[model samples]
Target: MINLPMSAPTFIKSAEIYRSLRKKGITIRKTIDCLIAVLCLEHEVRLFRNDHDFLFIAEHFPLRIV
Candidate 1:
């Protein structure tokens, strides 16, 4: 798992992304979404989420979600 700051942006961003993806017919767990966000921010690794949340995060940050 990746580490992340306990900040509003992180939580809000994660939730917003999670909701969007949930609406898009993708399946993603909240725990996994949070992990992905942390990895993207901390490890600088690309994320691959079949969920809408990844798409949303990619739009704002430098991330490659496949």
Candidate 2:
């Protein structure tokens, strides 16, 4: 398991991601999910998730869903 730390840029990116999704009419029930997506994006880490929320995020961002 990797321990990834959330930084200021991560938070900023997460907000951007959340707002972008909202503008696109995609509402992620959990805000934390966006943060998680940003983490994977910024780190170039592929996410293994079954949550549908990740699907929306992956559609826009370079978040690879494995």
Candidate 3:
């Protein structure tokens, strides 16, 4: 597995984002999708996923999907 230094701010921000998204009725899988988005943004790396939401976010965000 790829390792990343889990910063305090990143963890807090990710949790906040996840909670807000869950409150909006997004699925757990979607919350993970958003987490992956945060990771990709922080690392400046591309993500390969078949999840539709992942693709959607990747389209609008600075992610290269493959």
- Using lDDT as the measure, which candidate wins? 2
What would the per-residue lDDT of candidate 1 be over residues 1-66, giving only the tens digit for each residue? Answer: 544456666667666666665677754545566556755765567676677766655665567776
Give the Cα error of residue 48 in candidate 1, in Å: 9.8
- Please provide, for model 2 over 30-64, each residue's C-alpha lDDT reduced to its tens digit, 9 standing for 90 to 100: 99999999888878898999899999998888899
Can you write out model 3's per-residue Cα lDDT over 1-66, one digit (the tens) per residue? 677666777767667656665566654465666767777778877777777876556544566777
RMSD of each: 4.9, 0.8, 3.2
| Cα lDDT for residue 50, candidate 3 | 79
Q: 1 or 3: which has the higher lDDT?
A: 3
Pairs that collide, model 3: none
TM-score of each: 0.47, 0.93, 0.62
Q: Which has the better lDDT: candidate 1, or candidate 2?
A: 2
* Candidate number with greatest TM-score: 2
State, as a TM-score between 0 and 1, how close model 3 is to the true structure: 0.62
lDDT of each: 0.63, 0.91, 0.67
When sorted by TM-score, best at the front, the candidate numbers are 2, 3, 1
